[model samples]
Target chain A: MSEQLATVTGLYGLLAEFREPEQVVAAARAARSAGYRRLDAYSPQPVEGLAEAIGHRTSRVALLVLVGGVVGCLSGFALQYWTMGVAYPINVAGRPLNSWPAWVPVMFELTVLCGALAAVLGMLGLNGLPMPYHPLFHVRRFEAATRNRFFLCIEARDPLFDREATQSFLERQKPLEVYEVPW
Target chain B: MTPPDHVATQAAAHSSVQPPDAPPPVLEPGHTLSTVTDKISSIVLTAPPPRSWYFGLAISFALVMLLMWTITQLLWRGVGIWGINIPVGWGFDIVNFVWWIGIGHAGTLISAILLLLRQTWRTSINRFAEAMTLFAVACAGLYPLLHMGRPWFFYWLIPYPNTMGLWPQFRSPLVWDVFAVSTYASVSLLFWYVGLIPDLATLRDRSRHRLGRKVYGMLAMGWRGSALHWHRYETAYLLLAGLATPLVISVHTVVSFDFAVGQVPGWHTTIFPPYFVAGAIFSGFAMVVTLAVPLRAVYGLQDFITERHLDNMAKIMLATGWIVAYGYAMEAFLSWYSGSPPEEYVLVNRMFGPYRYQYWALLACNIAVPQLMWSRTVRRTGWMLFIVSILINVGMWQERYIIVVTSLHRDFLPSSWGMYHGTKWDWSMFAGTIGLFLALLFVFLRLLPMISIFEMRTLVEEEKHVHGGHSDTSDPRGPAP
Candidate 1:
């Protein structure tokens, strides 16, 4: 990775790599406690408390899905009512045109449908996905972040990210490699 | 950089989590993260598939061709080509539609319902089953569309403004079917693809070919497996499972409502919804077993999809099979208890009428045969479970046929009471959907990691354990090619 970077590039941050998930967890905790507010951990699998160590301990996806479901259900019912009862009402078997009982099935379906769409899209939107180019990709060993390696990166944007001091700080935490991430 | 052998922590991460008498690990004990990734991705990235894959794909594609031919002819000739008439308005079209959709339920149950139940073993097989669900729904959706004489006017089911100021009657279960089936398909796809993103990222990183990297990269949506992202991912995934639980139960309930609302004697029973749901799970688990047995063998993935998976699935099938059997008993009792001649006649007609053999065969397939699974030997053996699953599949199809035909074949007017038999087009259409299902499955297996790689990674106690050496440049595996 270092060999591939012959041209001068701006620094994005320092990336500390670890072989095991525990090491990355420990490093992320240490970095967070040391006042690095902007940092992220990458792992091959979900570590039980890794996100908490990096300061993200709560999620709003469930609430978003709830709201989406209610809205979807109401709109579904409205659509049925407007169409069947108001817009194109045709009497059948002398039955009332406002057949609310029959509307429950479509409403239930729409609620699940819209709420699920929110669940996926909201999560992805919050995570800033489809971001094809990131500074982490510049570091070749980072590819293993999807495989077996664990990584904790202290971004340059962090208030306390001092390059030399953070390098030494990560070294003390005992990682496999501490590499400079290029922008 | 530290040396290859620093501090190791060889046994620290694992070894203490398991009790002495716990069953075998869901994943076999020795797999590390690298090996799991290697084993799953290798199907697409390294090793070519076995010759049997080509053979299966060929047959499925040919079936797809048959389906296309039948659909073409049906479209040209309208619904009249099938044996459907006034008395038997629904034949193989509705039967296959119901059967295929019912078969889809097990996948969601496995992926979403089992996940909510905190069943850890679902980690291995849920991905492919969900794929099966989507494909089955796809197959189910085609029938109702083709059944429409003017297939192009299918959009009339949707509540949209058209030139004629026409709107679909929202009070109809058929319209509800439109929304339910479409929603099921969309949500199943979302769940499946959301689960796939991280693994797709793994493939994108590991793929050696440039085109593979580009294609997988685009599909991955640039997933980096960040901790924050994983948190939101898990959050969204759990919410989806929560939503899908009721949705899956509701899907079959609505399908049964399509029949239960009818004035037909056999179709109007109140037990239809729960009975239909139970029968759905029964057939769905059977289909899962049918597919999983060969898949586990062909991939040599005994480690991931272990014997316990088969055992648990067989147990579920047994339980659901009893529910189905109970539904059958209730149907009979209700007919006699109601004391209505039409209701009693529907029951007697199913038993001794023109379709008595079909009823008996359905009993043998769904009830009598699944009873064999009570033996430990049958549940444990792959071939035996496979055989039972195939039988159950056939039995469930027969169940639908009897329900659809026997009820409609006898009306209040004996003059209109006539038997229904599927014509060539109907038979071909049914067979073609099976081909369509298999063809989609074949494509899915080739393109994606059928087993969820990231989920499998989570199963291991210590993912960081390298097999023979460390990862990265210093590894003894010769610098990762």
Candidate 2:
């Protein structure tokens, strides 16, 4: 608990605000090249190159949704087969008990349902959302990151992070302002 | 620093590729990111509700109360209160069910299908259109539940373990409808909510009031516009759009199966699936235009929901309208060509039967009225399109009525055949659902950013690119030099 508390209260990052998305992307690339592995960028809208600059390229959401769809499809068909073919089977014109054609629509619906559920749940899980508290929220001006400003932050947890050195490096990118984000 | 003269020359050269009157700008003039945030957010966060809003809300609330009253009486009485009987077992309830569900198709088409196709104009209208889908589905859902008479036993539709050891018949189209409609509602709600998160975060940040900030903050779900979040967000959004695109085709096809799987002459045709899908989109676009015209005028949002958006939507309606017209022609031609007396008789009855006027009116409203859109002027004129949309809405409803009642009323045995006329209860229920739809819409406009703020910002970015400004030249995953 004490270790966790120490981590929580520790210095979070040094944040630099840039006037343009290009500057943020350039700064992120510079920070990555300078051996800072734990870094992030924020902008009013998606800046094309910022994700790659921060080295976040691939996501597992599609794979999760595909797995969900397959599961949903199998389960849906299985449930119908069990109910119709085994439990309380009423002979409807002596048709086959396991009517696969009859099972397609429900299976399709369930596939979509699970696929959609996976999309939302996987996205939230991957993004770590509903976290109302974060160290970055400590900076009042950071709110503008959702409006007009662009920001790049280098985390203190990075092996090469030194408060003074990181501050100087971000300053070299010619940002509008630099601030230490506190826990 | 960039030279002003050089920028102007470049901008001029770019504009030269398009016709003299390049499409009206997607967004209004003089909008910086800050101004965009301020203008849209202020509508929800700061501006007082206009008197017109209050007036409309009151009327809608009154109608909703009437709906509640009718529903209460319906529960107290029974399905006997409806006009459905004899050969015409389905009445206004089914017609309205199909109508409301059809109205929702345009939203999915606009938001999901258009997004996949990379149509940027969808950004302006997708948010509100998705909301309309949710509300329309809600209204559509009310019919089947209430039409069952014992609304409390509606859970019987679900595949749950019961002491009675019964399961929903898998082969029945009615059962398929339960899955289709419910899945549509769930997916649409999630898609709408997922799209709202970023804009909600914007609302969270811009709101000055503590209570407003807290409310929007909770809804925003701690979004900070991080690049990592956007990466996952874009992926999830694309996946959902892909998933929803199939649903836009499938859900209505399943709905159409409820009729096609039957043995009735008009309902049993193989063409029902594609025909129903086309009609759904046709009516759905009409409803969008119907709602958008009044909405843009009321809110003075002519800049955001511009003439071009309406024009584009009108063009879609025109195309889909032709498809619906083709369905009608094919229905007539196939009935005659099949040489099946019962099928031929149904078509002849539809034209010259007791409901002859309705058939003609349906064609006039659905087919003839939309022909006005061939003229660019009518499509661009908001009022003209709005009136046309109202006509199409009425026509679509009558089309459903003709398909359901006319066929059922004159089925094989003349002795069992009977006419269906809507009672006051029917009108009340229909009006009530409309009231519910409108009230929900008004609340959504009041509380949410009807247009996506972040997406409109992307449009601004593109506009800057056209003007030879800081172009977004880097790939989404590549580093800047």
TM-score of each: 0.93, 0.95
The TM-score of candidate 1's chain A against the true chain A comes to 0.92
lDDT of 2 by residue, B1-481 (tens): 5699899977775445445455666776556777777777888988997888899888888889999999999999998999999889888989999999999999999999999999988888999999999999999999999999999999999989999878899889999999999999999999999998999999989898898889999999999999998988888999999999998889999999999999988888889999999999999999999999988888888878988898899999999999999999999998899888888999999999999999999999999999999888888899999999999999999999999999899887778878999999999999999999999999999999998899888877775555444223322212211
Tens digits of lDDT, candidate 1, A101-144: 88999999999999999999999999998888788998999999
Model 1 clash pairs are none
Please give the interface root mean square deviation for model 1, in Å: 0.7
Q: What TM-scores result for chain A when each predicted structure is judged separately against the true chain A?
A: 0.92, 0.92
What is the Cα-based lDDT of residue A45 in candidate 2?
A: 87
Candidate 2 reference-contact recovery: 0.84
Model 2 misplacement above 4 A = A1-9, B1-21, B469-481
> Candidate 2: lDDT of B288?
94
- Distance from true location, Cα of A69 in model 1, Å: 0.7
